[model samples]
Target: MSKVIFITGGSSGIGKSIGEFLSEKGYVVYGTSRNPDNMKNHPFNLVALDVTNPKSISNAIAEVITKEGRLDVLVNNAGMGITGPIEDTPTDEMRKVFDTNLFGAIDVAKAVLPIMRNQKSGLIINVTSIAGYMGLPYRGIYSATKGALELVTEAMSMETKRFGINVTNVAPGDFATSIASGRYHTPIFENSAYKENYQLNLDLMDAHVDEGGDPIEMAKTVYEIINTKNPKLHYKVGDFMQKFSIVLKRILPDRMYEKLLMNHYKL
Candidate 1:
């Protein structure tokens, strides 16, 4: 029997790639997006889903369950980014980011847990970022959202392990995705403090993402994990720079790490 997999944010970027990859591998992939018409048809099913809305989440799941009796995998990949200095970001916008990235994942997991628990077997993969592990200047709010996901995935892994379910958190470094460009940004005060410095940090981060790793690499990693009999709790995928950044965070002193980031960003 073919395994059924449900994916959120499957319209573009890494989610789209992962959906396509898994479907080709013979999994019954059910992907979700806010606008299903915009998504190009693949080998799997596409359903309308909006993570921020509980009704939308429930309806999508119901539709899938109605068609397929069992779900073998759930990939919580739907997320948005908010880039700006922490102090400059409005509280409303910050909350919106978390609503989509963190709470959204939780909502999906909550809805799917019962089915997985009843089945006594399943895998949940949360698509986090390197920001989940380390914070960056100007992108503090975005980092916080991913950080929340990382911690949630950790606790979820422990809680679900005994139930025969696996929860894996994937923290990919800068990938060639539309996240940097497609992110919704609110303008900071034109004459406010840190405007110049904040702009500089945003520019640097954008440049790095423009020249980052391939999305297909991350997609391949997701496919590999899904095929594994026993998936691990966490995985990191990126180029050499990302690996080095993780290492620096591990060994370097706090002040030294801050200094390194400052120099790297040319702040």
Candidate 2:
């Protein structure tokens, strides 16, 4: 029997790629997007969902279960990016970012856990980012959201282990996606305190996106993780440089790592 996988944020980018790739691999994939009208006749089942809305998530999951009878995998891939200095960022925007990236994932997981626990088998993959493991200048709030998600994935993995459920956090580094380009931008020149640092941060992000790794490769890595009989707690996918950078960040001193990032981004 084909396994059923449910994913959020599947309208585009990495989530969309994963949905297509997995469906081609014979999985009964159900992907959720905020606007389902534009997703008609897609390769996979596209359901209308707004990650920030608990009712929307609950209804989508209930609809899937009603038709499929079982959900073997859940991918918390819905998220958005907000970039600006921590002090300059609006408090309401910061909360919105966390609502979608962290709390939203938590809500979806909570809704799906009962079904998985009852079935005594399932996999939960939380799509995090390299930012989750390390912080950057303009991405303070975004990093915090991902960092919280990574920690949640760790705790959830431990809690779900005995129930035959596998929770894996996949952290991809600087993938070539519209996420970076589509990030919410606020004019730092308007804020006297952040004016001096505004251009520097903007240039840094542009350079990073120019050299980002391929999203398709990240999608392939996700496919591999899903097919694995026993998935690991975390999977890092990206170019060789990204893997090396992560290693250096893990092993080097704080000052050294900071200097490396500064030099790499020329910030």
Candidate 3:
């Protein structure tokens, strides 16, 4: 029997690309969306899923398990982004971001852990972002969510190590996707303190995302991770400049690294 893989937020963007790529490679792939009918043309199987809802997540996974009897991989790719200065971002909005990006992924992963343990094998790939390594202006909430998820994945790796399970974090920098359009922005009024800087940074960041690296590269990376029996804990995908930042931050002095990032964003 073919290996079974379930991907969240698979109706479009990177999730969709990964699903199709893995399917072509012979894995039985199931992709989830809030509306399955709209994604019928997608190459992989479509299941209705709202990661934020426990019932929806359980139902989706149960549907897959009922037919497949086993889930070899779980890709927690369902997430949303938000932009604005952290101070200006409302409490509710921040919670909403975490609800989807952080908690939703955890909920789904929890639901699948037992199944994978029962089978005595599985892989969990959490689609995090480069921001998880460091915070970015105007994307503070988004960064916090990814950063939290990264830590969760790290701890999960340790806990699941003996279960014949593997977990990997795929952190792509500025991939060309629907993320910008799908993200929520904090409201800015004339009195807003960071309004001007926020607008400037948001526009520049949006351009980077529009011209960001190909999602196909990320798909290939995911495939490689899946094929590796002992995959690395973290895989960063994007241009050299973005990838270099990860290293630069580690070696450079705190103030110097902060200065470099500030200059890059023209803060």
Q: Model 3, range 41-139, lDDT digits (tens) per residue?
A: 678899999988999999999999998889999888999989888888888999998999999999999999999999999999999999988988888
- Reference-based lDDT, each prediction: 0.87, 0.87, 0.92
Query: Going through the candidates in order, what is the number of backbone clashes in each?
Result: 0, 0, 0
Encode model 1's per-residue lDDT on 171-229: one tens digit a residue. 88887788886786758679868888877777877888888877888879988898898
TM-score of each: 0.96, 0.95, 0.98
Against the true structure, candidate 3 reaches a TM-score of 0.98
TM-score of 1: 0.96
The predicted structure with the larger TM-score, 1 or 3, is 3
| Model 2 Cα lDDT, one tens digit per residue, 38-103 | 876787899989989989999999999999999999999999998887777789988999999999
The candidate that wins on lDDT is 3
Give the residue spans of candidate 3 off by over 4 A.
Answer: none
- How many clashes would you count in candidate 2? 0
Q: Highest TM-score: give the candidate number.
A: 3
